[model samples]
Target: MTDPIYAIPDIHGQDALLDEALERVARDGGPQATIVFLGDLVDRGPDSRAVIERLMQGQAEGRPWRVLRGNHDQMLLDFLDRSVIHSPRVASGLSWLNPRLGGAETLASYGVTAPDPEAAHAEARAAVPQAHRDWLARLPLWHEAGPLLFVHAGLRPGVALDRQDPDDLMWIRAGFLDHAEPHPWLVVHGHTALDHPAHFGTRIDLDGGAGFGRPLWPAVFEGRGCWLLTDSGREPLTPAE
Candidate 1:
């Protein structure tokens, strides 16, 4: 059997689901199996702070886990460090704290509340621990292991890996998602959530919209094939032709 590398994607602040997914991973792959987190670890749910702390604690315990930065994660950092409410990467002036984006829920996870936007910023700054900010800032945009290349969002097709824009890695959708050609590596990502994991010939998207109250399923890759890791066992994922 090929050695398995597990991946969890777009956690989006659902600590309960995160816990269940981690347990499933451990049950299937043992304690030392390499796990890649494809970003979006915050917002859209009720417990972003707990989610961050759990990942941090796992890494500190010396687990072979790689965490990538997602657009939501970046938005949180921007709000805390620069007071940037709206992201230029997104259109329609969609601020991070917009109800749809779920930034308010993240702030609540940190026990932060304020009377106004200005006060919110200051309160968030004081409430969020410096270590979390440091960890979020240090997360890489992508990770490569053998034939697998992991990212938060899909990459821009035709751009070389080194030349890919950071924003595109975390926020892009159009070209990357619609592209029919295979990427440099079998790109594993989670940004565009589907009712289930999507297996295009070139990429596998593991985001099952845990933030939207759907299930958060972890997937494992071995060579070019994939499977959804569940409590019972592995469920094979066939690529779309």
Candidate 2:
């Protein structure tokens, strides 16, 4: 009697959006659904801190949930998640791309501000919460859900499924997205949001860009059968009973 697992997609700091989807999962799951987040928990939105807090709160309550790292999280991790840019050059000429990745808004969440847009990103990165840095750095790239292997992104072409590296597991999205070849595991992923959920002959795409009002979706696997759970106001791929 294995309880069904609900595979979540990349969040990108939209807490309100995520809550809508989670409420749906709670209603459908009945305390048995294990929520496995596919990473990219922060960036491109204003609620990165709130997102992590809510996720941690749920985890503390024994509501089965697992968090993985996404590329945005990796960027902060590589930069030490606390390193900031202090150069004057970036102030007026070179604007930082932090907002697109949700970093700028998050910085403001902590009462932190930059001398310039770029400096704001830098100072905030340098001041990222310590607890968050460790959590992001320690996250593994993927998870094994019974017969499925969940990655933040997807596997590289020509690489064996079991031998995929953590970096690729967390960041490889280009080739994997273009790859039409069949995969061994039902590699559930969320990094590369497509025009819609792609149904490759051998793989299932559930990303569908949750942060863009698409909703943080969770895939419900019924043995070999699969379906989706989202709050995007669209009918699910199947009726979620």
Which candidate's lDDT is highest? Answer: 1
Would you list the clashing residue pairs of candidate 1?
A: none
Residue lDDT tens for model 1, 1-241: 5688999999999999998998899898898989999999999899999999999999999999999999999999999999888888777787788878989999999988774668899999999999999999999999998888999998889888899999999998998898988777999999999999988878888998898999998998888788998878999988865
Could you estimate the TM-score for every candidate?
0.97, 0.81
The candidate that wins on TM-score is 1
What is the Cα-based lDDT of residue 115 in candidate 1? 43
Per-residue C-alpha lDDT of model 2 across residues 179-208, encoded as one tens digit per residue: 866666677787777656665645667777
The lDDT for every candidate, in the order shown, is 0.91, 0.68
After best superposition, candidate 1 residue 33: deviation in angstroms?
1.3
lDDT (C-alpha) at residue 203 in model 1 = 89
